[model samples]
Target: MACVYSMRSSLFWMMLVSLTGLAITGCATSVSTTTDKPRLAQQSVLSTLWMDRAGEYRALCHQAFNMAKLQVDRRLSYHRTLEKPLAVIVDIDETVLSNVPYFSQLIDKGEVFPRGWKVWMQMSTAQAIPGALEFLKYARFRGVEVFYISNRSINEGLTATINNLVKMDFPFADQRHLLLKSKSGNKQPRRDRVEQTHEVILLIGDNLNDFSLIFSDKPVVQRNNAVDMMSSEFGKRFIILPNPIYGDWEGALYDYQWGTSSAQKLKVRQQLYNQ
Candidate 1:
């Protein structure tokens, strides 16, 4: 397991460095009116987050899974029952498969999402996160059913996503267990489907939205309060992976309004800590 994970880690860097170089060149300029500095700044930060060998990016992923394993052990010793089948629900994209490469590819071309998104998904070359495969396999070994509940569109990226998971040797990569995004983008319905027969012990993902709909584009203060509200459940039943490069958390900064300029985003962050 150590040897294979190390190899995957190496492959991840190789792709990141290659794609970072490509993005630096591709996003040298954009069709949008946003200045070069903002695009250039985003590329720099994203590359550093994705490419750094010794960084918080790697450390946080490791921490999340370490805690998840502990959480699972505690759950079994203290809470689980034989009444229903046990399951661990996980989001697909950055939670299990590191889509930083796809994000890099998109930024490299200086293109936006909905344009290159499907292309990247079809390529389906995302590598598994460092501890995700082993931890999830551990869950299954403990008699837990692993159900993937991703917000990825149902008919669009489902097949490629499953293929990606299978290629990474993740267990339970099948249709019945793979629930995709419905038109609502709210996952509770699909989660409801799983709860009918399985007791979902852990909900794992990089984004809060992956665990519940309450996180959908709320105000920044409200979102923080919500996290505080469920603080107890975080490490126990909600395992959140780290994803600094992109997520709804960042979207909340700009009021969830699409097409907000990069300068505007910077301005908001600048004010986040002002007295």
Candidate 2:
């Protein structure tokens, strides 16, 4: 009887050892698999705050639509006797669509602008901005035309942009209404074309360049002065949207030079902050 009990204890010990060995082997495999795997970092506090406050964002959209409606009404009233079609020029990204997801993807990857920006634009998955769809529909109902004046370089993605707009049910006419950046990155030619057929009553965008090509290449101080000059036009014939993600503001601060190395750019940015 004693011998039988000893044999059972030995078998139990053997099984315990085997299980422990398996567990260690499995853990080592897992560690090896995850050692060099990529992972996204956490978003910044500002981004988190903005994303968390859905109610505020909705209110902002409402305000934007109200402002747009007022401009549209004013334009229609002014062009009541004009033989030409009444139209409004609107910027696509940030002003008419939300590309937060694309930016968030970049943030997750611990990346910054330029490369990420190119990739985001290439994806062309930007959805309509909050209240933009409603405002466009309202304008359409009022017999006003909407033109998308984007700085997105003309390329294979142009078709994708149009298709995405259609999918989102935005009021888009064909290639005629979509103005892309020319080789010069100047928007005046496109604006000229729009003016030929339609009297532009209001211009809406998150950037000053959307309204006119004047400030497109201006320095920071000059740009501010230009904005001051046009301050009176804002909220009347111009509706500016809020965009904190990226803009010409960054360009001006960085000397409008894109060919500089990343380290040099970082140094310049740091110097600006120190000043």
Highest lDDT among the candidates is held by which one? Answer: 1
Cα lDDT of model 2 by residue, 6-121, tens digit: 99999999999999999997654433222121221232336534743567766776787789898788767656554888888888888887877876765566555544666666
**Per-residue lDDT of 210 in model 1:** 80
Off by over 4 Å in 1: 1-52, 78-81, 259-275
lDDT accuracy of residue 198 in candidate 2: 91
Encode model 1's per-residue lDDT on 248-272: one tens digit a residue. 8878877887686555555566678
Highest TM-score scorer: 1
Worst 10 residues of 2 by lDDT: 32-41
Pairs clashing in candidate 1? Answer: 23-108
What TM-score, to 2 decimals, does candidate 2 have? 0.77
For model 1, what is the C-alpha lDDT against the true structure? 0.79
Model 1: ten consecutive residues of lowest lDDT: 29-38
